[model samples]
Target: MIERLLGTPYERRLLGGGRFSGPTAWLIAIMMFVMLSVAAAGLALAGSARLVSEGVARRHMAQITDGRSTGAAAVAALRAAPGVVSVTPVPEAELRRTLERWLGPSARDPDAALPIPVLIDVELAPGAAVQPVAAALKRAVPQAELISNSGRLGPMLRAVNSLAWLSAAIVALVALATASAVVLATRSALAAHRATIEVMHGIGATDEQITRLFQRKIAVDALAGGLAGALAAGIALLLISAGSLASAGEWTGGRLLGTLDLTLLALLPFIGAALATVVARRTILHSLRASL
Candidate 1:
């Protein structure tokens, strides 16, 4: 059905690609670009949120200032715990380095250099309660404090999830704008060519033939716009991925956030094109029915 509609030449000469499309293609392209960007953001946000929400991804720090079973003993005890997954004690020097990397020039002062916490990172199995890990750490080292600082992370995840929702809403608005443009253009074309269409009908042309003719141009215009938008978005995402990767340079195991694959945004063009085509066809069919 689609092939036949696209193949129709009479509609091509009638709509001629130039009469109706003009700057309308540019409008769709711009709308598609913004839509696809939002779509990419929404997809990445959802994936990151799911990763952070996982129970197995939970991490805690055993900040030991002074403890009996400190360092190796604490790591071994935590390793043997039922719910615990892994225990790696961070070296003081490495901790200072990480702080310096984040703090920059402020961390260079010898007198102002603060004492880094003796941090032992604890990983838990999926769905495991933090209570068991904390209990095991306290039992092993009386002075080892369980620093489950997921308190601040909860708000961040909520914020990402909210941003995802906002992105999705923006995509919806863009889609509406594209559809509206197609509908309005189709109507204007129909109004301009009404007499020619009626004359064709008087000869023998069915309403379907006339409708399909106009639809071919609408589909072509939509596809052109969609392609432009898709290419722009694909280039932008590729550039961004080259700059930042999710697994690279992560300090916290629990708070893994950068982006999931934004390649899904590439499909937005086809989606937008299909949406525009459908809206145009429906509007044309309705207009034909009303004219009769």
Candidate 2:
């Protein structure tokens, strides 16, 4: 539509291709920037929640206080149990290394030699009942303790759910505010150009033509504002990532923003433009009809 309006003389006259009033462009830019930030935050938090959920859902662990031999027994029993997918006995030395990675240089301190329990990781088949599987393991290895993190999963799932709702609300509010901004701009332009529009009406120009001019103009302004907003959002995200670099690995499991995630976020500018165009056209149509 913008390309089609390039050679339209009257549309050009109406648009003027100059800066809109002071607050209009800034209003859009600020709104879009906040929207982008909220969107990115929601996405990142949701990703973290998903990681926690998947980590908990896909696996369970059994701790053996007796020794490796007892842990091995638990592993064998888990393998033979129905709905058991696979079991891996975690070596004490490997556990020590993992602790070391987390604790860093402090792990080498003499006080760091605290006893770590032997661990056996268990995976269940799809749609399997955890209680039955856990009971079977306990029966097979009477000394083994079944660790169920009902509390952990519950909180993570709830947080994910809450984030989803919050993100939706933020998106809805941003869209409403953006549409309102476009409508206000259209009304202002129409009020300022009433005489010109009336003359155009007398000369046989349809309301749709005038609406297109406003749509194209608003869309272009929104595109510019959206791009500015996106850039600001990008900078903020980068700064945050930089600040959290030391803990990013431990926090997000080393996979924070995948390519697909960033790709979706990058579409905000175009979406803003389209939204602005729709709002402007609708406002123009309604106003024109009311006047007629």
Q: Highest TM-score among the candidates is held by which one?
A: 1
Which number leads on lDDT? Answer: 2
Q: What are the RMSDs of all candidates, in order? A: 4.8, 5.4
Cα miss at 12, model 2 (Å)? 2.8
Candidate 1 clashes between residue pairs 3 or more apart in a chain or in different chains = none
Model 1 score (lDDT): 0.74
Q: Write candidate 1's Cα lDDT for 1-292 as tens digits.
A: 8657466555566655552256567878888888877787686676667666663247788887744246776787788887887788886667666788888755655566475556888888778887877787778877778776566578888898999999899889888878888888889889888888888889998878787787767777778877887789778866885645444224223323333343456567777778887888899899998988
Please, what is the whole-model Cα lDDT of each candidate in the order they appear?
Answer: 0.74, 0.76
Q: Where in model 2 is the C-alpha error above 4 Å?
A: 1-10, 17-22, 63-136, 243-246
Please list the residue runs of candidate 1 whose C-alpha ends up more than 4 Å from where it truly belongs after superposition: 1-5, 18-21, 52-56, 64-73, 90-118, 125-129, 142-144, 246-264
Question: Once all C-alphas are superposed, what RMSD does model 2 give against the true structure?
Answer: 5.4
Cα lDDT for residue 59, candidate 1: 77
TM-score of each: 0.76, 0.74
